[model samples]
Target: MEAFPRAILIDLDDTLVDDSSNVDACWDDACAAVAPRLRGVGVDRLRAAIDRRASWYWSDPKRHRTGRLDLRAVRRHILELAFAELGIDDSGLARDLAEMYRQLREERAQMFPGVIDTLDRLRAQGVRLGMMTNGAADAQRAKIERFGLAAYFDHIIIEGEFGAGKPDRRVFEALLSAFDVAPGDAWAIGDHLEFDVLAPMRLGLHGIWVDVRNAGLDGRPGRPHRVVSAFTEIVETPV
Candidate 1:
């Protein structure tokens, strides 16, 4: 809290952008639309099944790495598995559900409040800024462009383009080196504790966790150097 770091590496989703906040609502909308056609499977049941499969799918680091690149396919696969669990054999319906969720999710995507102002302030203060996000190149780039975020970052690294993502110390090392800042003089901020916090902290960068949901660490491994509830907190006038 003494002074801003010389450089900061930020995450895109849930940290700068409000991407994950509407997930449950979007899933509800998608499930409700297809519930009637799912034999006796109600909306709640279908949603639960899909949620379970999705959790399991992403729980594995290997699948999470591969699945994040092709999220549409991941959704479709989750829907298919859910349908199968409920005795439904319609791949077309599963695809439809996946598409619906995608559309609904995109419709509601927006950056978190004060993100642009915070980034602008940091930049104005001569702080080097960068963004490191994981996902397909095109998909990640689209979000960057859509949110007009490209102007704020000096370096933008997408996992698909970078050949790897967070939890990989190489990514953090490369970005800090790009900014010509020592790890201890830079900060890495993101929502994922392991990827954004632990990984960077291990390499000597100050790791700041954005707890958007106000979710406590809940005994998660590796405490962040700083924990904040919003992006704007990063630039709040030091007390």
Candidate 2:
């Protein structure tokens, strides 16, 4: 743990980038689009309903679409389900709202504090850097291009392009293999405990989970190596 890792892997959303900012805006757009259908419900109430339904759908660990590799389909499905819950079972309406949300969200995506500097420093130190994120091709690529993030990474592996996702040892293994680095000589960091940290830990990589939400780590195994509340901690000593 004293030596720096030879290769480094990082997550996209909430780790190196603050994707929620645009996601919130996208939800605002969705609310505006659905306001007319809310008969008696307030905009705030319908927004909550849609968010809850979408969250419920994506929170299913075993659901294939939860990986969000196909953002268009998954998001459309989420809105469709939400509409059904609100007695507005119109697929066309759901599709339009989903497309609107995605377009706005991608246009407004922003990186987290110090992401560029941190990645630059790591790359300067000869650390092999890779971005292993689960997202749709266009949506995820838009973020990389919008923020010029591709300059910092030696590998940009999106699950949509790679055909695999985290928690699957194959995805973790394939990354290290591509870099020709052993798991023990690499580190993987992300916002999600299981997908980013726990899975990598099992693969012999030093997995660090950035719990930006202040989620307590109690009762979980300490194999994640480290858990911090900020993204800047990635550059700290012994990372």
Best by TM-score: 1
lDDT of 2 by residue, 31-69 (tens): 787677656657676577778977787778666645476
Off by over 4 Å in 1: 237-239
Cα TM-score of candidate 1: 0.96
TM-score of each: 0.96, 0.87
Each model's total of backbone clashes: 0, 0
- Summarize candidate 1's per-residue lDDT along 1-239 as a digit string, tens digits: 45888999999999998997999999998888887888887888888898899999999989999999999999999988888898898998988888999999988999988888889889888999989999999888998999999999999989999999998888898899899899999999999888988899999999889888998888787789889888789887534
Clashing pairs in 2: none
The weakest ten consecutive residues by lDDT in model 2 span 62-71
Residue pairs that clash (backbone atoms under 3 angstroms), model 1: none
Top-lDDT candidate index: 1
Residue 218 of model 1 has an lDDT of: 81
